[model samples]
Target: MAASSTATIGSYELTSRAIYEPPAAAVREGSRILDETRRLGSRYGEDYSDGGVESVAAQNASAELAESWKYPRQNVFRTGAAFWSLLTSGANDAAYGALIPYLEEYYNLSYIIVSLVFLSPFVGYILAAVLNNTLHRRIGQRGIGITCGICHILAYIIIAVHPPYPVLVLAYCLAGFGNGISDAAWNAWIGNLDRANETLGFLHAFYGVGGVISPLIATNMIAKADLPWYTFYYVMIGLATIELVSCTWAFWPNGPEVYRQTMDASNEDNQGMKEALFKLPFARVTWLCAAFLLCYVGVEVSVCGWIVQFMIRVRKAENYPAGMTSMGFWLGLAVGRAVLGFVTPLLGVKVAVSVKILARLLEGSLAAFGGSGAAILPFAVGAIAQAKGVKTLQPIILAFLTALLGLWLCLPRIGRKQD
Candidate 1:
């Protein structure tokens, strides 16, 4: 059989690479291509003779497949840059909780007024989500890397100057926008890797690492050294500078044109954001996951943002011990992601997510103790704290965790359907 020979099997063209290449790659690409075909409503169940097995096996080689770090080689640098970017985000988020006391003391502000810092970031995040596709269309990942770095750098510089309350809130908004862009871009890029669950586990584990260390450093600077609250941001500025350089260099080759080619944007049937949100099984999964994460992150950052205050005010803990509470939380999160990444594939997504949510619920319930949209829930919790008390966080945590579990259960398992 010539490489170009036609093997009619449900409207697909089989090629030589499918027969010559390893079956693993062929099977992987074959399944993905079939999924795309099914999304387009194609029917496939044709029979062929044993002699036609290779012909039957042939599939489009250009279809994207999950890749490894070494294949492209440059991905190694790209992945490192992503890891650093996430670390910076973690550090930025965790530092706020530790600094809350100092912020109040320095500015002579009440809880709700300070909570505006947490709430202000919400606007930046929403804007990022709205503009993400447009940014991708215009500048590609390279542009995203540069833009995010600049946002962080400028934000940190503004904070380091000890600006007024309104200006400080605006600085956080810029930082949040940077965090939002980097979060979306890197997660999408890394999700294409082989064993993505495990890879992403390590990727986010770095986030945990940052979360763990940030409070420690920020706390010591203020409590022990008696430095001003804004000094920590100078360090943040340095990190952002490095992030800008590393990411820009790594993604320079992957500009707008390359992004278009990689995405196969010219394909008439390619799914858009609208289709992804409205498609049958995908729609169910998407909505459920969004709801679950809104609850999940609301809990995670709310705790990171307010747990220090809770401990200091309600538990009567000193600054260092109070800061440790947040550090401990991040440590557990990091360790769990790294360890469970290995276990999740065996358990499957549905079961794994259920277990995680249930465990978080149990943790919250037991705490009598513990613990945003990326921001709203955290902001709401802070607002509630102003009216009720930080102690109310315990019940709020329990409620959100319970909701997380419910959302997880509602998620439809999206898989290859035989039709």
Candidate 2:
């Protein structure tokens, strides 16, 4: 069969690259092609034959499959770039930890208004589930990403200029929308890429690194400078500008059809966007992700956000300065994640979880009983003792509990491949 006598399947245009050969060569090449096609079909079930194809169909299918293979690589590249960009942008801090303090000090925001700022992102996330596909179709992933990048930069600038609280709130809402949309699109794009599990882990690790670094950067600047709260916003603005430029350059000449294909297949269960996002097997996974995120952020923020104050006020650990203590928490988190990445695959996620749980228990017990000197332990722990010098243990105990919760939450699917 000629390569041109091919058919389209999903986004792929199939063609046969088989050459005329002797009997033995033909048999070898035929078997190889069959194996390759099977593998391709398994990976992208939407793009290939449900049943065995005839000679003509097989030729067409082979060409389409070949075309389809190119996308996974492109997706992996784009996803990795997006992940890195997201971290360097500094938007995550504004949405997560710094928002409360910024609002309180700069804007004198009321409690209700502050709560709204914090909650708005989740609403944006949910809304993204509805809007993601449409936006992808209308503007393409690259375009949406570029647009999101611009929005993030604008939001940072708005906050840096010290807009009115209402305007700031609107700016954050816009930032939330950008974050939600970009997150959904990039997640879906990366999920479809080759070696997706490893890529996902790497992407998230970068996110973790960003989370760890942002607070340190903000706190360090504040400690050194005599400027108002706006200095941090300036830093964020600078970071967001870099992200915008990177995204724009990376995704030039954007259009929907250039990257991913539209999914036109019909489904009984996925009758509407909400049903598709919130229904069935995915609903549980989504809820689990949300719960894990909540716990992870809470523990992470508590330690990094409060540890310095806790150290200065409660522990009175003069040896370790405030900046160093916060750095320690982030360093611990980075070390933990790095260790987990190496150890999880070797020992398996279940074993890793068990090990972390046991380690935390031991650490917590020691901190609770061993007193102030327990701060010397490799892991941070938080414990409150009745004695004068024992309060230092509280942070240590908190760190242990935080690690335990994270391990427990991640245990179920630690080693399992995603569907």
Compared with the true structure, the alpha-carbon lDDT of candidate 2 equals: 0.50
lDDT of 2 at 60: 56
For each candidate in turn, the TM-score is 0.79, 0.59
- The top-ranked prediction according to lDDT is 1
> What TM-score does candidate 1 reach?
0.79
Best by TM-score: 1
C-alpha lDDT of all candidate models, in order = 0.74, 0.50
- Put down candidate 2 lDDT per residue, 200-318, tens digits, no spaces: 45554665576667666665555455455556767666766766676666555557875444344323212533442367653454344444444455445445544554565576654
Error of 1 at 277 (Å): 1.1
Cα lDDT for residue 350, candidate 1: 53
